[model samples]
Target: MYPQVLFQNRKPDRIATLEEYRKSGGYEAITESLKNRSHKDIQEILLESDLLGRGGAAFPAGRKIMTVSDDAPYPRYVICNADEMEPGTFKDRVLIHADPHMLIEGMLIAGYAARAEKGIIFIRPEYENAARILEREIGLAEEAGFLGENILGSDYSFSIDVHRSGGRYICGEVTAQLNALEGKRPNPKQPPPYPTEKGLWGKPTVTQNVETLCCMPHILRNGAQWFKDLALTEAGAGTKIYCVSGKVNRPGCYELPMGVKLSEIIEEHAGGMKNGAEFKACLPGGASTRFLSREHYHIPMDFNSLREAGHRLGTAAIMVFDEDTCMVAATLNLLEFFARESCGWCTPCREGVPYLKDLMWRIEHGQGEEKFLSMLRKQSKYLWISYCAFAPGAMSPVEGLLNDFEDEVMAHIRQKRCPFKGGE
Candidate 1:
């Protein structure tokens, strides 16, 4: 019942069909909004819902909508950012594969509210199945007159396009994705002309995360207060699809109320540690979030709680590590991914990430020194100087390793070998 809003159509056969979704009252919210509500009315409902972006930043959705210029130009655009390539993050992929129409309905609502003439689902290249599912569903919606010109017999018209990812992690960023969709090299753009003001051929645009958009129809269907009450935390609203990986026995996604305790997720939902291993630490939200040790296992896994605890709810993709796992190796693996994913657009990311990766490799291989650790510490402090969140995300694993496992780094130097190697 907790995740009913999202997992309502989880039955394999029933989930993928338009008829089932319609029978389940799918698209009713968008139909209602498009037919009865004005653009301002929809925005007001969103603002009152207190929904936050689920794409790592946790920014307010209503405020983002308000930033779009009321009279910018013709053909405003809305992009559903489905290019979810963050390491250990797969919640969006599951959502897309299981219930694509939910995303479509949500996009229609957002496009209508933003007064957008077009919408695009910029999905990841690796998600071939999801891309196929979306492509098929779009055709269905179009045939049903839910997507093409003149929807539900109204003047409001919106069209959606699917753009496959450029096989780069940078495209997950809002502006970077816009650049890629426009047939340019994917790289982060400087702010101030923040998409909503000047985007997609210099027209006003509103870009939203897939998961964020998926929540819209639910919010509109059940009042704003109902959405707010879905959270376990007082400060948060709605449910969060938490992705579990690493040391957990049952590593998969679970849509639970926000503010659910970390222990509940790890022990109850994830079925505790695998192979009887003890939990050492975890990257609470994919590779880019700070590590939380056993001390933080009791904290609520929500936006405000994680922030207050000096971490972020990044993608809500949790990567756990057991006692037997080597922190240096784990950190090195994440660094390798970030370093390779850098778009070479800025020196701080392109250059710094490789250097960080090399440092992690050396340390993981038992060739590290006090100087290497010092070099790592000094280099990581400046990784946040990049133009976008990429470099800063690259630095997150380093921060976690240093903060929670400095002793392991020192042990590599003191013992002249990786102590955790070969099962210690």
Candidate 2:
């Protein structure tokens, strides 16, 4: 069994109360920070810890903190991004249900480090229960003096608010979420003045996903070296909350050490493929990431390892598939999601995603031609030219299907029918 850090107190039923959290050294980091640490001190420790954002992007948390200038204007905002809308991902919801205080404590510490007095948990509509849990727990924390107005006998004060928000897949993006908070149309904005420099009512803002923030209390409580030592790989810093699904015996979240082998996760942790299913391929991350073929089955499920292998550790939401699954149909299903959830801000995504979806639709329904494959290959490249990462992300499984499973695709084209489905 791997050492549990984030899920240490995870209960089978009900939430861990404030008292329970306190007993397990929750919020101790805030005390330690107030008494002994400075902004630079916190920044340096975070940098040294090398805590990558667990929110799929893997951006360095320290760099984001450092970007918020120390002399930046007052009313700086720190946002806890709880919009866990990525398909096949639900780690955030699980984390909140297990222990909500960890997120609150993380926000407090982050707010102090960022010199922001206000913290907002920007949650999605689907997570109604998770949002309520956070709201109730936040009030409890305030009553105990962990939040609002000169916290814990110190000059530092931090307050958190839960912003139950409009649902959109694109709003999960930082800039888009900020815009949504301001009651504007949610759209991804390019960084010149990044969110850390200017955001949310034009004030300096620091935004982080729930899983990333949840790691803060633990990182600050343990020293940087201790945090680094938690990973199985030198390149990794901490354990990953892997959300496993599809064809697996235990389709749930497991907080395993970073850089654990994909085989180990599927075999030892996830109880292997379900009901004697033979593994064909898997979307190693969320729906947005490219598929990992059977050849890479033994690959280490880490950011560096996956990147080096021309893949991503996207949300770590491994969607496994059995041999019976059709690659073309699977890609089409993913495209259907991209088509519907598209923000329609840019041409490539607004038009390109649906066009691809249409092509995939025809192909699956036996209207595909030999020329359609090359046409797809040609147009899919344009998705990268879009305004945001969405188009590019949506193209992942398609690229994988074309790149790794061209034989399967050719089978469909030659037969004028899906190989897995009997049709003329």
Query: Which of the numbered candidates is closest to the native, going by highest TM-score?
Result: 2
- For residues 91-199, what per-residue lDDT tens digits would candidate 1 score against the true structure? 8988887788999999999998889989998988898878888888999999998999889899989989888887888898988887887898988789878889889
Badly placed stretches (over 4 Å) of model 1 are 1-3, 12-14, 422-424
Candidate 2 lDDT over 1-424, as tens digits, reads 8889999889999999999999999989998999999978888888899999988899999888889997899899999888888899999999999989999998987888898999999888988999888889999999999998988899998999999879889999999898899999999889888888888898899998888889888999988898889899989988899999998899999999999999999999999999888988999989999999999999988899999999999899999988888989989989999999999999988999999999988888788888998999999999999999899899999999999999988888888889899321
By TM-score, how accurate is candidate 1?
0.97
Best candidate, lDDT = 2
Q: CA lDDT of 325 in candidate 1?
A: 85
Worst 10 residues of 2 by lDDT: 415-424
Error of 2 at 86 (Å): 0.7
Off by over 4 Å in 2: 422-424
lDDT, candidate 1, residue 237? 93
